[model samples]
Target: MDRQEDRHRLDLRLALADLVADTAACVRFFSRLPVPKLCSADDPARLPDFSQISRAIPLAGIVVAMPAGLLVLLLGLSQLPTLASGFLVVGMLAMVTGALHEDGLADVADGFFGGHTPERRLEIMKDSRIGAFGSIALIVSLGLKAVLIAALLDRYTPLEAMVILLGAESLGRTLIVWQWSTLPAARPDGLAHRFGVPISKTFKQACIFGAACLLPTLPVLPLPSLALGLILAPLAAHGVGMLAKARIGGFSGDVLGAVQQVGTLVFLAGCLAVA
Candidate 1:
């Protein structure tokens, strides 16, 4: 009995350590923010296995966005111009995330729109050059985000606005689990291939993460209105998945990024409308 108890405790300790490492890996991958220095020797590098870290991806989003959210709140409360504050928050987040998702949005726009064939589309996305399609998409998406943030500033108190931002960021990352779960890689290489599909169990854990993100803000929000905001995420993801199926025949890294970007926009938009 003593031996069994020790073994169980040992196992639990190892699991917790792995969780901390994976969380650090995720934060490093998803943001430019400095990590906690617990794993200083390796925290800057992207870890080999994203699947192990998938569970923390949503939390990573909250981690990355919180600073930007705070900045927005500060600016709003200080009586800065709403649109200017919104754009600054958007730009700051772009920098903080190393423009990862925005890059994906541009690549997806160029690939999905510019390629006459699926192979051509995938090739274009990999080119790293911005085309007319990518240019327009970047401008539009950024514009939309700024507009939404500004609208939220007008509609809610600074703290309430921050809640919407936090929830949207968390929920948006969680929504990527659907893309990974439902789709295959567009090519035989790259992130979609490397990470593969997260198992059903993993996917469910992501949903729980997203729920944890949203539930905290619920007390301040109307249930019916919050439902309206919450409903946009999956519906938008379904639409993104369907388009990927028809166009690329599967998801690529760009598709995953596109999902996050769209999820962010629609979730915040829903919250604004409902609020």
Candidate 2:
């Protein structure tokens, strides 16, 4: 019994260490933040819970996926010398997020537009199958993104293009944190609970996570942009919150994702318009 107790205590310590390391890894990935190696795929022993990493998921997403947008802009720059890369960068970045929120947009559209009642809407949203309204929503959203991005790339240089990609992604992820903190879970025991931390932790993460977004904007836009972004984030979140209330009756994981993606686009659009 004594030996077994010792082994259990040792296992618990190791598990805690692993969770800390994974969270660090996620943050490092998001901010282009660096860290020493911690875990490997070949390890035979099971590590810790993946829940801690959820806090940094958005950050990690931006780090891993933003480059795709850059690549698309580069391709456009090479092919069309007259146009700048900014638009392409934005468009590509949207794609890089893999139309993640766009999927939410589609789901919401189908649910709200087609279903007669709130319960019916929720039912439609839960269905994995896509509907006509959803399909149309996806097409239109993607088309808008493609056109806007192409326009930006046409106007801006490669460096500006890069900043836009990074900024938009970081901003988007930061926006996602707000939803996580503020919105009530739409479905009981759904995906939100798995990823949801306490509001206090969520706020701390938002502040730290926000730096990735705000730092880049300092050079690109003026104080107005900064002020606007700060103000707009919550307003945009509130708007989505209302939409969530009306449609799904609350925020689901899909709605949360939609908010992030939509919020990013809205922020970028507002910034550029000010510029």
lDDT of 1 by residue, 1-275 (tens): 99999999989877767666766777787888888655433454554465656877787788889998898789889878888889999998899989998999899899889999999998999998899999998899899999999988888788988888888888888988778778877788778566646777777877787788887778767776678778887799778888888898888778888899998898777776753
- Measured against the true structure, the TM-scores of the candidates, in listed sequence, are 0.91, 0.73
Q: In model 1, which range of ten residues has the least summed lDDT?
A: 39-48
lDDT of each: 0.82, 0.62
- Candidate 2 deviant stretches above 4 angstroms: 1-54, 81-98
Top-scoring candidate (lDDT):
1
RMSD of candidate 1 to the truth, in angstroms, is 2.4
Please, what are the lDDT tens digits per residue for candidate 2 over residues 1-275? 99999999989888666545555565453333344555542122333222344455545555644575557546655866423343454445445445556667778878878899888988898788899998987776556555555545655665565566566666766666666666677777766555444365645665575675557657765677556756776578678878888776778767766776677666666665664
How accurate locally is residue 8 in candidate 2, as Cα lDDT from 0 to 100? 100
Clash count in backbone of candidate 2? 9
Quote the lDDT for 97 in model 1.
88
